[model samples]
Target: MNSLLITSTEESTGKTAIALALATLASAQGASVGYMKPKGTRLQSNVGKILDEDPMLARDLLDSTDDLAEMEPVIYSPTFIENAIRGQEDPDALRDRVAENFAHLATDRDLMVVEGGGSYTTGGIIGLTDADVANVLDSKVLLVATYREPGDVDDVLAAAESFGDRLGGVLFNAVKDADYDRVSTDVVPFLESRGIPVYGVLPRKRELAGLTVSALAKELGAQLVTPNVPTDGYIERFVVGAMGAEAALSQFRRTKAAAMITGGDRTDIQTAALEAPGITCLLLTGGFQPPGAVVGKAAERGVPILLMQTDTMTTIERAEDVIRSGRTRDEETVASMRELLAAHADVDAILQ
Candidate 1:
């Protein structure tokens, strides 16, 4: 079977997104696909067993019958890191478990998409780094590079050098409109000249990257003050209400489907946000109960008011964490992601 290892230069660069998209494309072409994440870093407990989030997502999306436990063979729990650092955990044993699980999942499959934990060098301590796992599976590497600035090219080049001939190609993800010209006219040509193949350049779409109100509420441990708010509604931008009422309104007006974060006591800011178009939700901090008038107005405007006990900065940090770790579980987002990947990414080249 042909195997591909999907990894990134850093975390939250949409490695899973690209992997899932490729699986969909491959399935459309009548190829049977299998997925496995050898070393899972994002640990969550479902009932009694510890599980990784991405493997479960893959199981559901790909319609795989593999047991969740087997699909994610190794989970780095809170104490796992501590144990590994102190020489309590054995790297060889971990590798054996991963290999055993991988063999089981890859049975009767044409392609196996193995996802890495974080970056290329993330699991070095456990001897299961991206390159290590790729070598173990005899898989070619397709690195997902998130475009932040021009300097990001250096990071991608360095990773390419590390992978050597094992590197299949590079996919440029989340490229903003402003950087498209440079990435296409400059970066792509530059990389191609250096013997690196550029497989895709996907543009940034807010809907694909933004957090939903339901996700935000869950992340902030927030209480919904408004009844029957659409939790699935996407918040494309976040505006902190630290300025005066007019300034806050002006800022909020700049983006669609914005979530305004403000102190609960700031009725002026609250009122301004509610009045603005495309204000999907309000995130009230400091545990202060919003006045009944503001709540009533929000209810009237059909805007969800999420109340949290944390302070403003803490609230912002929590929101950032949610966005960074968030994935698209909804069908709408999934369809858009597939469309984007199929349009921008060279699926033919990847499958070849």
Candidate 2:
């Protein structure tokens, strides 16, 4: 009977990660939890099957018996969005489908964890936004926001107005250590005074954020030129090799466990990256191929070379986006979330 909808202020705010963590936490309390994502946005080829990855992950992780199709009744595909915007798709009808799905999962369940797509405003075109669906399900809302700057406080205030009485609280997740003091001292007090409940402030530790070399290649759709190289290395961050070879080498030296992005033609920079420590993978841009010797050196050093079609700027942006989007997948991340939420969040209140 207790249904909770997990949404966020922006995309890639670890909604799925936090949802999975909360579901497990509730289960540990002897409550039978059911999971559903009424709408999925990150559709991808999961093991050669094209579907929404989030729902599949939730289903597999929870060991639920509900069909994937029923668990996620709607996907925010391009065609679906286009039809919805053109008035061919009905909002209320789609919402009814979501409600129907929830009905199936609610049997003998003590709690239901529903995850919204993209952001709370994702389904606004069809009028089935997170707030809309939450109202339909009569579920309380938990807004998981990432605090990148002080201005992020505005997003929480705006969400409080939208959720109104249904707004359980706001959890400041993925808050970098640098911004911790400011959020705890200044931001938390401001929200609390204005009748907003600040549930948790979780830090962005490297273990929860790093992406494997294999995941980077898979998510980016890049071709791995060196197939025999190490693919499991963690790329904690990425750097662009736009500067001179000496300058770029200096950056590669300081950065640990990173993917170096540069043009394939910049053989000197590529060589420097190979020489530097902790270069897990090399991303070659603009479809250019590095020389045989460069490839040989990379392979010799056990570094994987990925060929990307985008230019330097676009490649950098895409890499950053991938890191943010793929924040949670493996069991390692889920385990880390348990400790994090227990330490910083009011889990008992959030679930109840």
Best by lDDT: 2
Mind giving the per-residue lDDT tens digits that candidate 1 earns over 1-352? 8899999988887788788778777877888999999888766678987777788888877788888878777787667778899999899998888888889889999999888877898888889889988888888999989887889999999999978899999999888899988899999999999999999899988777777888778767799988665677788667899999999889878767778899999999999999888788999999999999999998888899999999999998877666666554454665677898889988888877
Q: After superposition, which runs of candidate 2 have C-alpha atoms over 4 Å from their true positions? A: 46-50, 221-233, 236-258, 272-280, 286-289, 292-304, 308-321
**Candidate 2, residues 190-302: lDDT per residue as tens digits?**
99899988888998867676878888888788999997887988897898999999999998998888999999789999999999877888999999988999889999999
Model 2's alpha-carbon lDDT is: 0.87
Root-mean-square deviation of Cα positions for candidate 2 versus the true structure, in angstroms: 3.2
Question: How does each model score on lDDT?
Answer: 0.85, 0.87
TM-score of 1: 0.87
